[model samples]
Target: MRLNYPFFFIFFLFFINSTYSYSADCEKPIMPSDAEWNSWIQDIKEEAYTEGISKKTINQELDLITPQKKIILRDRCQPESQITFDEYLYYRVDKSRIMSGKNMMKKYKNELELVANHFNIQPRFIVAVLGLESFYGKNQGKIKTMEAVGTLAYDRRRSNFYKKQLFAALKIIDMNLVESKSLIGSWGGAIGAVQMIPTTYLESGYDFDGDDKIDIWNNYLDIFASVANYLTSIDKNPWSSDSTWGREVIPPNNIKDIYDSLKQIDPKGCGAVKRRSVPKKLSEWKKLGFKKINGDPLPIRDDLEARLVAPDGIDGSKFYLVYPNYKNILYYNCSSYYALSIGILSDEIIK
Candidate 1:
């Protein structure tokens, strides 16, 4: 059985209370007048009616939308300086999570195999990601989806993303798959076992339980299937055995960040090198002092181009040999650190 979020309703009550304490300054401000609050609700009603979101959905969602402080903090915060990849992964990949993930692998085997068959995803990797994202659903987060979306829309930092997510959250409630009280998620709006944003959940989620519904919260099979389907939609199952996401080493002195000009290579994901072009065959890299960590032949051949990235960079202890399939990890997240962590976690679990 999949883990269900038990406190989702409590979070909702808090959010509903936050709706009226309209302080514009966040840190220090006065509450909006009754007229202003009513006007805001009126606007929401108008949008709900026009957009086909039911009145029930609008009322329920609005009732649960309290302003959250974390959203404001995340929206306003600037990017911090870089942390070491090893340190990042230390927190990201750990023993207990992987052990729990392995158990889930056993518990959900039949459904996972079914999803893997259709999507061609390696089940271990998917399960590893599941463990990493939400602790196998033990902690899906407590922030109300409505509040986070509303906060983001009002904040104006990445308004397009937040607004789109806001619309998607309302649509989820309107569809009746979730209650407003049940729409709790990460501070950024990722929900349930898969950590999917509301838009992604609505766009591509699946129902493998044969319930005629897609529920990411209560159905383990459906959640795994949805995630597998999402991965396929992003890359047609680029992580399959025939494909390679691992990278070949690059000589530190020889390569420039040419991949910067190669965004056209991805359908939506970035190239292996972000904006740079991929490297040439193993033979090419070998000629350039790029050898395998195992002292064996580099996995890639000379005929193919690979993304050259070292999470540790040139001065670091380890190097990454990237393949086009490896670039597919970025579709899950754009960060090289994130993708590498997933790859490494997948490796650790598989081993």
Candidate 2:
């Protein structure tokens, strides 16, 4: 059908306005000029060579590296770190993840048990880490690992840390554990089902299946064993299956003064570290009027020392008498919210 001239003109104007409005709303991120990016890539390639990366691998990977503005933005706007404890827990330890973790526990019962027995780590905690890290391997991220690390290494905000990771990633490729182009992971460069950074992968990843390749991306055995190994490795503090992560407690009225007297500013650790009460024997806490959330007597072991932690501060939320095992969780991910969610989710999975 032939359109009228007036109608055609009106339709053309509407299309143009809509297109321009959308473009304005979704403007592209500003990035360095091509010449600057190219020069940076060349410098990275030279550094990689001095660090003993093969010339062929450097050319194949570093030559094509480009700045990932999207990743830089993501690093700057990490919503998880900014959210409240309750909000973080609600999203991270929801019903679906608990159910999925339980199903995974049942499905991998034998393997989990074997790894647990061998490493003296709890099977449920292993499963919880897997669920939290990649949703039972359902979402291991889609960004190329090399590109993400390389971009962050050049971005200058945390260059020293990301550069270390970038070099470790190069070593991973050089050793042929995974091909550079095939390695995909989070925007910050954490890889595999357990979301391990490159340094951790090199230090603790194991070839559990004895297939000669530590393929955490595809092998559940490797993933589970690797996580257990990381927690129980000799260099790291061994996880004690007999001890729990912590118990929620009610502190005495003078807890604030007590906390102030004992608190140490540990800037290198997680948020929980800032609020950690001085370590006291379980009996001392009980004597000082702290009790379990359910009002039960604290354990009578004088040798068992624990720090009282109130993640949302003492007045706003439940307090916990966190044991060494709780700190072990922080070794995996320093966020107290992340560690608490894993512990809570693991308990549900076992139930």
The top-ranked prediction according to lDDT is: 2
Give a tens-digit lDDT track for model 1, residues 138-249.
7788888888877766455566777778878898878877767778887777888788888888876887767766778778888888877766665353455565457434
How much is the lDDT of residue 12 in candidate 1?
34
Total backbone collisions, model 2 = 0
Worst 10 residues of 1 by lDDT: 1-10
Model 2, 95-187: lDDT tens per residue?
999999999999989988988898898999899888877888887778898889888888787798888888888888888887666688888
- Name the lDDT value of residue 66 in candidate 1: 54
lDDT of 2 at 149: 88
TM-score of each: 0.79, 0.85
Model 1, global lDDT: 0.66
